[model samples]
Structure formats: structure tokens, C-alpha cells
Target: MLLAHDDEGSGPAVVLLHAGVADRRMWDAITPALAHTFRVIRPDLRGFGETPMPAEEYADADDVDALLASLGVTDAAVVGSSFGGRVAMELAMLHPARVSSLVLLCAAYRGLEPTESVRTFGAEEDRLLEAGDVGGAVDLNVRTFLGPEAGVAARELLTQMQRRAFDVQIAADQAVPGPAPRRVEVDPTAIAVPTLTVSGAHDLDHFRSVARHLAEQIPGAEHVELEWAGHLPAMERPDAVLALLLDVLRDDPTVHAP
Candidate 1:
């Protein structure tokens, strides 16, 4: 399937892959600015946004390639947050010819051991679900993902998105062909595309490790930790994140013509 997406603007393409906690709407805050100079495509990953959870086994990277191909885009810069970031890396490794650049935000990778706080939060969230406390689970996400200093609006936005996710995936049932097999672990060194890894200064240690590892493993990949942000820096500080994105895009050799 092509997947539900918002495609706009015109120029060298730039796809916005959203965080796991939120969907395509998560890019609403900054899409307008991005649209001025780039063809921005934001898609709701399978089972996440307006897209229905499928009953068959599927590769997300395949879905992404399908979406881009359907749009006639041969290559583009990809920016992703959290799980979306993981997807971005997979795209670069699997379809190097189609990825011009990568901008990853707090992306997790295979064999990534969660930090103590993340582990605690995950167990607590699972317990909440088992206890049928959806609201409580949403609250837990706000506290766990958003930093302590995050303002009320950020908290509320996260609460709304998290609750929406529960309303969709939790309320629905999905069946895979069999056991949901994990994709082969991507070889980071195989990603020759220019990459930028961004994390929040206040983000979880697990994601911090992700940013560091990506930078160290992917030759010439840039890494930065934005101040006053947590896991979802795009939402918490959209302007700052947008500026960084513009900087990377403008300087990318792939983005400019020879």
C-alpha cells in the first residue's frame, strides 16, 4: 500500500518520517516552513496514523519505497524522528541509490538495550495497559518522553497524540502471517549517504547512545544535541529543529546541482 501521507512543496524532495508516539500530524508545526523550499512528504507509518494496521507481514522500508516511487521521486533527503529515524537508516542501507541524505532524531537501533528509566517506563506502561488505564498510560508517556522542563503545550500535544495512537492500535486487532520476524539488522557502515544525527540534550540515555553510535559508525555523519529539548525535539522546539534542517539541506552537495 502507498500509505496515508501529506505531500507538498516543490524542489529536491525531503520526506518527514514521524516518531512512533505521534503520526504525520506531528509535522504540522513545521511543514509550512519546509514546504517553501522542498517537496515535503510526511507519511503515517503502518498502524500509526490514519493507516490501518495490516493483517499480513510487511516491510516498512518497502512501503516507503513504494510511496516515493508512486510519487515519481527517484531520490530524496529523509528526516526521521525516533522509530521513524530507525526507518530512515534502513532506507539508506537498503536503498542507497534512493537516499540522498539522512537526518535522524533520537533513533533506536537493533540490539539497543534500553536505559534504566526507559525500561522502567516500558514496564509501567505495559502494566497500565494490562490494568486498562489508557489515560494513565498516556500520562506516563508525557512524563517519560517529554522532559521534566517541557511546557504545558508540549505535554498536551503528546497526550493527544499518544491517546490517539491507543484509540487506533489498542482498539484494533492485527494478525501477522505468523511470528512477526524482525528485519535483518542494518549495516550502518553500508550507509554511504551524508547523515546527521540529532538528539535532545534532555533525551533518554538509550536514544543518546543511538545518536552517538550512528555518528561514530557512519563515516562523516554529524551529530548534535539541541538544548531545551527531549525525545521529540521537532515538536518541542520546531523552529530550532527547522533551522538545523535548512542548514543541512542547503549545504548538502546532493541537494545542489553540479
Candidate 2:
């Protein structure tokens, strides 16, 4: 199915996939900036934002590829944050010809084992959700994902986005039956496109490790760590991340600086 998306601008396609904690709106700060130079496509993946959860089993990577195909786009730069980054990698792996390049921001890798901090965070999130304290869960997410750099506005926006996500996902869980969506294993070494893996120093060790692994495994993939960022750098510092994205897209993708 074609996931709900916003398509703007008139140049090479640049798809912005948001973090798991956020929806397409997560790119609200940088979309307009990037759209000035590229065909910016931002999709609200299933069960997020404008896209409702699917009743049938489906893969997010397939949904994204289909969305692009419907838009008449064959290849484009794919940028993803957190879980969205994992889907971006899957897209590049499954639909190799459709992705010109990849930019992973605190990307989630299926191969890595969760760190202790990550496990604890998950447990707490689960407990809160099980107790039906969605507000608590949302607060937990904001605290964990956003860093010291996040302003009040950004934090508020994240709270809204994440809460909406939980509401949609929870409603779907009650209605939809049978297992969750499955992910395809991504082999970083097989990804041939120019790739950039970004990690935040303040992020959990699990994500940092994933970033390093991607950079090392994916040929020519450049890894950059943001000293001031947490998991959602795009939301934390849109200007800085936007500049980094433009630089990577306009110049040599393999070359970058933090």
C-alpha cells in the first residue's frame, strides 16, 4: 500500500524516513530546507501519523519501496533515523536499484545485541504501556531520545508525535491479530551505494555500536558522531543536520565532517 506521504520540490528525490518514536512530522524542521533543492518525500510509515496500522501482515520496507514506485521514482537518496534507518537499510538491500545513497541517523541495526541501557529502557517503556500510562511512556521516550540540546519546542513536538504513535499502534494491536511485522536481515557489506552512518555520543551504546559497524562494514560508508546530540539529532538540531545532509547530497557522499 502507498503509505501516506508528502512529496515536494523538484529535483533528485530525497526520501526522509522518520525515527520510530516520531512520524513524518519529525522532519518538519528540515523538510522545507531540503525541499528547496531536492524532491523531498516524507512518508508516515504504517501505524504512524497519517498512516493507519495495517490489518494484514506487511513489511515497512516493502511499503516504502511501493510508495516510491507509485510516485514514479526509481532511485533516490534515502535518509532514515532510528528504526526508520533500519527500514532504509532494508530498502537498499531488497530494492537496491531504488536507492541512490543512504544516510542513517542513529540507525537501528537488526544484527546488534541490545545494550543493558537499551534493555532497561525497553522494559520501562513496556511496563508503562502495560499499565496504560501512555503519557508516562511518551515522557520516557522524550527523555531517552532527546538530548541536552533539545529545546522546549522540540521536546513538545516530540511528545506530541510519540504519543500519537503510541495511540495508533496500541489501537492497532487491539484490532489486528497475529504476529508483528518481520524485518529482513541487512548485510551492510552488500550495500554498494554511498552511505553515511551518524551516531550521537549521548546515545545508548547499542546505537553507537550499530553506527560503527555500518561504517566499517559498508564499503566507503562514513561514520560521524555528533558530540551534542542524542538519538534524534535531526530534531535536536535541525540546522546542523540539514547542513550535513545537504553537504552529503550535493558533494561527494562518502566525504563528510562532524
Q: Which candidate is the best by TM-score?
A: 2
Give the alpha carbon lDDT tens digit for every residue of 1-258 in model 1.
679999999999999998888889878888999999999999988777788765666777878888999999999999999989988888887677779999998887875678898888889999998898999998888877776555787778778888888877775543333323249567888889889888777988888988988899998887877767789888887787787788788885432110
Across 1-258, the per-residue lDDT of candidate 2 in tens digits comes to 779999999899999999999999899999998999999999999989999886787888899999999999999999999999999999998899999999999999978889999999999999999999999999999999998899999999999999999989998889847327875989999999999999999999999999999999999888999999999999999999999999999975444677
lDDT of each: 0.83, 0.93
List pairs with backbone clashes in candidate 1: none
Q: For model 1, state the Cα shift of residue 232 in Å.
A: 0.6
* Candidate 2 lDDT score relative to the true structure: 0.93
What is the Cα-based TM-score of model 2? 0.97
lDDT of 2 at 198: 96
Q: Report how far off residue 27 is in candidate 1 (Å).
A: 0.9
lDDT for 111 in candidate 2 is 89
- List candidate 2 stretches off by more than 4 Å: 176-179, 252-255
CA shift of 185, model 1, Å: 1.6
